[model samples]
Target chain A: MNTNFTHHQSAHCENGVASNLLKFNGIDISEPMVFGIGSGLFFFYLPLLKVNQAPAISYRPMPGFIFNKAAKRLGITVKRIKFSSPEKAQIALENNLKNNIPTGLQVGVYNLTYFPDEYRFHFNAHNLVVYGKTDNTFLISDPVMENVTTLTEAELEKVRFAKGTLSPKGQMYYPTHLPSEINWESAIKKGIKNTCSDMLAPVPIVGVAAMRYLAKSIRKWPKSKGVKVANHYLAQMIRMQEEIGTGGGGFRFIYAAFLQEAAIILKNDKLKELSFEMTQIGDLWRDFALNASRVCKNRSNVEDVYNTLADQLLHLANLEEKFFKELKKAI
Target chain B: MKKEEIPQDESNLSKSNVKELCYATDENGNYTTGLSTGWEAKTIALESSINTINERIEEAKENIKSGKASPIVYFMELHRMDWPTLADYVGLWQWRVKRHVKPSVFKKLNNKILQKYADAFQISVDELINYKGA
Candidate 1:
């Protein structure tokens, strides 16, 4: 029942799934390209929502947004389904495999046995593709993995219906139609514009402002919550910035790659320069993560470590603000 | 990051033989894909969180043994779930879920409710009721 699907490793899940699925449908698009057109780069700080006992921080949009937006921009038709019953979900997946369709699924990472134990958590927005089934096992093409893997039917079912935040509930999607011609230049411009607006949004909990708000919170955490609780929150923030999926640094690098690609397609030299600037910003994010981890581990003797970290974040917000503004003008 | 500068620090990911894909710059400053074994900062963050979870799991076991908490509390900690999250999974009210953390309430729970908790934890009812330790 194999669809002859080729597994391609990606830094991020949704972009990887989208790219791989598109390639299987004969589009031959790259992962960065898909991410760029999808306007995948984003930032949000949700003080009201708590995940793992810490405030929710997201470097990308909600699950399915990337692929859906990319598909729409590329004029590709996609079908997405969610089933309440696990039996019905299994039937639908099997039918897709029988027809040689590699279906994308949203599942929980916690129950995915193939993932390393250290990476498993209650987050339930992980994406993978099921290309075939043999006996009771399904062939999996998880974009974050280096090679193809297999999951027993029961194991797949558990992950598909894993409880907690953003439960998958046996959701699956795949592209059904691809346009013969794609207006690459226009799509790239639209993608860049959308990203610019999102990042430069005026809202406090969103975009660059969110980064600033998070910085202010970081400075207050240690003084208000005590050292131990503050350290725990800092650790959680660093995990969201560095450990989850591709994290903040990895995503910026991907976006930089997208800008570089778009530069050639749009014949814009400014985008080429902006790509390098984005990479530098990505490096700064990595530096921030490194320093924040040091503070968390108590390896830093600096008395104002929290304040230092806050300053670093503020710098990032300023740089991103300027970068997105320039990107808007360039596009 | 430059391709040559991509971190290959030893961490849980590297120890498990899992390499992360990253975008880096080549000699010409052109974007390219590279594989990072791990990074020290991320390793520290991950290890700390895991350690915290392990500590909570240990505390839950002690609480169960001392009759201060129910077997459900132990299972909940093992599954990395909090009261509200467990309630969401089992489709129960948060206060009810918290109340069920009491050993007395857990002992009096009906089979249907126990089954719901078991399903949420991905364990059989027998295992959920009789969980000793991992």
Candidate 2:
């Protein structure tokens, strides 16, 4: 009769039995375990979980040639002059050029004068002007000259006639701010600030790569979804540029560090290639920045040089586009 | 059943219950319970502890089976193993991106996997040598 165990006895035993503590980890109980499963759970399991980590990158330095004297000598100027008419100014230049006396001679504003690189190429009245502060000695205010150069009225006329250039643009020389008046310190700081503004944005070069990818995908298939994807990606590219244009220098340093560290983490051939290209681009950007600082000493011209540099960077980005397409396929 | 219900005992031989109980007598001549070791309860405790360990090890082994590479290498090219030498390895890694993974964590994982295959071949060679000796 006792062989028929009552439910009441089993319930009492079950209640006395302590609950088996259940802890969940990814390991399946169905398979053969190694290193003792229960021991791992009680000891090393939690510590074995992977921790999130991102690689590090660094900021490069500005080169030495940026502050050189040759770089600082670029400037522009706008002075008031007493010419009868545009036609007269043109004739005066022609006659002076023939006689070897460039009549447009004027004294320098700050003991030294500078000329713009763009104007140096041509002898046109469009950008070139002669100034006369003293009697016979006319200061050849050829906006083209880097250092102060003078010519007599005859010399100016002879050169002008030989050059066969037309009249200057306006009637009387207006008092406009000259390019030389650009505040150098403010300009340089501003230029640096604007170029580096986009540093906070992550993997900007990769964003550029993504945009190119979307573009190619569209061309290949031309679906609405592809177009949407591309448009979304292109927006990031534009955002990257805008940030860089505003004030991203600090971010550039961070990106450099990030890339440098990433160069270590990436083990695949494709990732290795991408990271190397990225680092190389960073180096090229530094070189371009140094060249810009050297070529543009003052503020306004610095901005101009930076704009040109940005354009060159964009041209280089086109090459990245082609490379990324190959990457997408390979990946 | 009735005979089993009544505790079986032999008067001629000694029967051991094996209960170890430590008790102290107070000044009032009363026994105070101090310690008790019941064999059946102790055995249950030990068995449960061992069972918990078995469960833990099972979980760990499953995780290890499913675990990806520590650095996580996503290889699209299966022909990577076909490379003959280390000289070719650098070129193969740099072929697509024009850059090398300097630390070579990915390459290390590939080599480790390759060694496992080599072990099986080595076992075959050992067996052949033994057969010739025999």
Task: List each candidate's DockQ score.
Answer: 0.69, 0.00
Model 2 segments more than 4 A misplaced: A1-84, A87-137, A141-147, A154-315, A318-331, B1-134
Provide the lDDT at A160 for model 1.
96
For residues A1-331, write the lDDT of model 1, one tens digit per residue: 8998989998888999999999998898888899999999999998788888778888889899988988999999999999999999999999999999999999999889988888888888999999999998999999988889999999999999887778898999999888999999988888889999999999999999999999999888877777766777878887877774663383898999999999999999999999999999999999999988889898444449989999999999999999999999987
Worst 10 residues of 2 chain B by lDDT: B71-80
TM-score of each: 0.96, 0.18
Against the true structure, whose lDDT is highest? 1
Tens digit of per-residue lDDT, candidate 2, span B69-131: 211111101111111211122223323222221124423435443333233222332331222
Model 2: per-residue lDDT, tens digit, A214-265?
2343233214334323222222222222111111121222222222333333
What is the alpha-carbon interface RMSD for each candidate?
A: 1.5, 41.9
lDDT of 1 by residue, B20-115 (tens): 788889999999998888888888888788878888999999988888888888888888888766888899989999999888898999999999
